[model samples]
Target: MPVRHTDPPPAPSRAPSSVPETPARTRSQKVADSPSLMAIVAIAAVGVLLYTVFLFDFGHRGDWPAYLLVVVAESFIVVQALISLWTILSSGHDPRDYTFNEAQRALYGNQVEQTMAIGIGMRHAEMQLNDFPITVDVFITTYGEALADIRKTVEAAVAMDGAHTTYVLDDGKSAAVRDLARELGAEYVAREGNAHAKAGNVNHALSITTGDLFVILDADFVARPDFLHETVPFFADPTVAFVQTPQTYGNLRGLISRGAGYMQTVFYKFTQPGKNRFNAAFCVGTNVVFRRTAVMEIGGIWQESKSEDVWTSMKLHERGWRSIFIGTELAVGHTPETIETYTKQQLRWATGGFEILFRANPMGRGRALTLDQRLQYFGTATFYLVGIAPGLLLLVPPLQIYFGIAPISQDVPGLTWFFYYAGFYFMQIVVALFTIGSFRWETLLLATASFPIYVKAFANALLRRDQAWSVTGQKGVRNSPFTFIVPQVLAFVFLLATSVVGVWQAQLDRAFSLAVFWNILNTLVLGAFVVTALKESREIARASRELRALRRAGREPVGEHDEKVVTPVLPEPREERRAVAIKPVTPVPPPRPAIAATQAVAAVPRRHRAVAVRGPAPRPATRPTPLPPLRPAAPRPPAPVLPSQSGPPSISGPLPGLPIGGGPGRARRSAGGPRAAEEPEPRTAPVPVVPSPRRRSASGADLAAEVLSFSGDSFSGDAPARRRDRRSR
Candidate 1:
């Protein structure tokens, strides 16, 4: 007989559907497809037309109010741009005879001194470290994480070929990890209460473990085998308590990761070392080894805030403990895999670091930190505050484009612009070259894209609101619809509206045009962010739905799915016994030699059976070979099991008649056969069997079964009766 089978659902389409192009230019189309280049052209055309009209119709007005307005707006833009430039240029010290450019100076001028101090301090600290013996303790902290990923970190730490003790602080209290730690002969620590997140975890280890110095390693980090050997020798100075190495991620190659890492390298390797020459090396959160005594002297590591590292460093410095910045990359950790996670991490650090500045300015009050230390901490805190700068820039253009209000009044003398505005503008180019000239294009774009989000986040931080940390989700593929596209949409809309208004009002001039142009430029820069955000949101939503369905189907652990699952009320739980539906039979010749291949082929399509009881399912048998008691068939009168009544015909006879160790005929017989006979004589009624309402109370059993089935195909070979028996025994 010819066999038929349902084709498998077409694999989900990965290629995104193409967005339809805008047809002939409608009003909405013009708005949506508006480009920055187009905006610039439109604004320039309007400016020329307006100038010509003004000269002809209202030539040389007695007051020159419009002229004054243009001059005033330009003056303000020039001054603001210059001041910003000066801030960037003065922000870093040029210790190695390094030169600056305008953009670099504008970006970092204000931070130059602090960067220099830290660099000077780092150099001095390194000189002092030329002499102390150091033993390191590497602590890897973990919450609930995949065992494989955690194992990779553990292995890296354990492989460190030096006088270092490796400890895995399992926050999840996972026995598997503990066992693995034991196997690797590393210290295993599990805590049952508040360790208050990561800070508490590290502190708990500090109190218990005995190491000359402590090194914090995140669960996703991999320490070089020679990390301790290379870094420990630098702690020779009795005054030096710790040496912080840069946290690098060898595996991360995303544009965002590279951009952020480039900045870090500049700060830590170049700027920080210069600052260290003056005793101003500050503590970074991780990949740093701290002196046991120094930490203990400060009453153990501080857990007062989310940024415990900074808080602890403050107290340590107050007590005269010194820190140094080591330029080498000794340990590697996973960078934010997704933009969402990256942004979250940045926001947390920014907000928390700022809070430290507000609450504990080592240099501000009569605190113990020295001049250099205070400046270092202040610089660290100011990094976050800088996020507002771009937002301010963004607002400037919009204000000029929307309203003709110049932030700087035109009443000021024109020559002041030469010294203050001109000088600042020139310095900005210098600073940009010095700080981020290598990735000028990308950095500029990112800066522009980040403006809105940065503004919103900065405002949120000022309000002292809580922002939960989110991990970026990436699968070795750089793609996300929301983060990549939504910003573009918003930017397009803003640019189009502003451009049309500027043109209609005939108010386009150099100042007005520049404002409109910059805004449009910013929109393009942020386009990727919007698309990626949307895609991330959609993926999260889909995952949540799947989790909920699994929970409802009684195929997942209760609490595991509780976080994502949505449960609906049912009239009552039903005992649903459905036969395992096997896939269609594939013809094969009968042969003894092909038995092994046949078995393997058959295994691929075997259907695994599972029954969902209204309440709970019976527990599995403890003994391996013991069979469960047979459940008597229901005692109701025999009913007809015709082809249609049975739901569908199977080529094989009734499932009950098939052999427990059925052969190839079972496959052929089941292919589109007639339905079983549902009706039987009343005299031959089957025995009544009702499951006892009560069953195991544990909710995880069902989930555990499902997980096992999916993970290892454990249920594929069992018959329906055997599956029930296995569960009940």
Candidate 2:
């Protein structure tokens, strides 16, 4: 649905009346409606049928067994391809599915109204002046995160608008962490043991603090100022146990971050929303708000497993509580910057997910989850188990080529197989890119590259190995050698060697060429992963060096240039200096004595106003010198006034109390010597223009003495002497 902005309704009683007319929907919509998609699927289907019927000459083919296997594999691929198309198309049929990019707001009208009602109820509750304010407790769990990183998140959390208190659960028990919490005015809590890692630390917090609502934030994930306002209101429905917002990463400069982010895009944007339709949106470890009562009722965060978030959500759902997936990302964090960290993070999550699947299966008997909910949990658990497929797919072709064990007989027509496979592959890629937000072809390469990590995780889970949680080193250079990507490297090598041998042997029949083409293609895909791993390692090293440089320079490290996370929403409290250095010369003009008196009077106590306003005035020793009067110019006749008329201009006037236009001893000169007053006289000496003094070079003592002497005596006393000195010069 398109969102249109307009003036809000003046009255709440009236419905929103200015919204644009909604577009009409088609009477029926189906997968076939998409001509391009249908064309690919149809082509793929026909190609598969052609290959199965005409290409497979089992009687004469030397590699008949391998050819038969290839046929079966292609058939399986076609089936899964169709299933994917069906799933994607069917997903859109439900009105509940929403993406962060665009939302069908009309479908969530009831949820919006209830959320508004929650706000209204809070306002009414406040009006009653009751003792209870909805208290929200935010827990930031950290092991050994940098203080600078933690400061940004903690500051933002404290700045969040609500009746809330932030707690820094320092599992590492670092004094620096404690001091930072103190500096930020947040409560700091530490535990004595690391029994269940972050989950245990949170449980410890639950035992100590109390609040109506609880929020869990990873050490690096920073919440928006309005996070509580946006998420907490959903709890108005008593059944809502928690609200989960998408966890977005702020930095995506590195290959590792970009690739990992692509994988997350699918889950948060597509899978989570689909799960929300059935109220099966499981909690993602952070950026989530939970009802305190609901958590306590569910026995706190499940301490038995590292995937406590999933287990706890399951328990809550089983107890008839609800969860909401807000699809919107109101918080942002950092992604693992190195291949090793990324792999380790994936391994831990994969292992834990499988642990939940085995130990506390949601589909177990007597569980209260609906059939849909059970399937959702099962699907989530099995997600980690399916990592082995890419590895197997990578292996089959290379092994068949090198060992002369072709998966399909040469009797099979290669073009039909290739056409069908290509069609399905193309359509699937298109649909995924259209549905999921981030649709990069490079992401497919990255996904296929991560096969080794998945295989290792699966192996760990299969062996029932008890894995402990190891914090993902959020930002650092951990040398992830090519060895970490052994699977891709080895696969690429095998495929390359096998392709060379097959071409050299000149088994260049259509089927042989097809097999070579498929192996080479898979090899290239695996090679892309190898290159990405190398790039990721180099990026991690560069990032680490840059980070260190920034720190040494006393500057904050840069993340995404445009989308930096939690940049200290509320600035750190500026340190107050005990003594402020006042410049010798102030910029502000000094207040006049009279105006200052008035201001002092206004500020002083009533009885002291008179004393403040009229404090004893300093007595003047001598009266101020009166300025000289202006002398009118003597007129010439009705003719021009000659230079003689303007006699030598007086640069200095007579001192105060002296006669105007003349000294006490000198007589004034007339314009003409008592005779030819009507005629103009010749120009006399040009008026002497004495320049102003260039600089004052008086010493401090002399300057002080001059000021005192001037204040004590008038300039009249020295006027004649100064005139004599000027004349001598």
lDDT of 2 by residue, 1-729 (tens): 111122211211223222122223321222224555455545554554554454354553446555554555445444444433333332233332223112222313223344344342111111000112244668888877767778888887776644466778766666676667777867666545555777767765654444557799988877775566557656545567788987777676666666776667656655565566677888988999987666755546776666778988998888777788765456777777567777778878888787767776877887798987887787777675445456556655655666767655466566754664565566556555544523666566666677677666767766887666766554333666575767668777877787787666555543455556767777787776677777766766797888788899899654311221221011122222122223333222111112233333343233111100010111111112211111124332221111111122121221111011111111222212211212121222333334325214656554433333333333234535544655676
Across 180-203, the per-residue lDDT of candidate 1 in tens digits comes to: 666664566654453346776665
What lDDT score belongs to each candidate, Candidate 1 first? Answer: 0.47, 0.55
* TM-score of candidate 2 on Cα atoms, chains taken together: 0.60
Would you give me the overall lDDT of model 2?
0.55
Candidate 1 worst ten-residue window by lDDT: 609-618
After superposition, which runs of candidate 1 have C-alpha atoms over 4 Å from their true positions?
1-135, 408-437, 451-496, 503-512, 534-729
Residue pairs clashing in model 2 are 55-411, 55-412, 55-413, 66-406, 66-407, 66-408, 67-407, 67-408, 67-409, 70-407
Shift of residue 538 alpha carbon in model 1, Å? 6.5
CA shift at 547, candidate 1, in angstroms? 8.2
Error of 1 at 376 (Å): 2.4
Work out the TM-score per prediction: 0.54, 0.60
lDDT of 1 at 186: 57
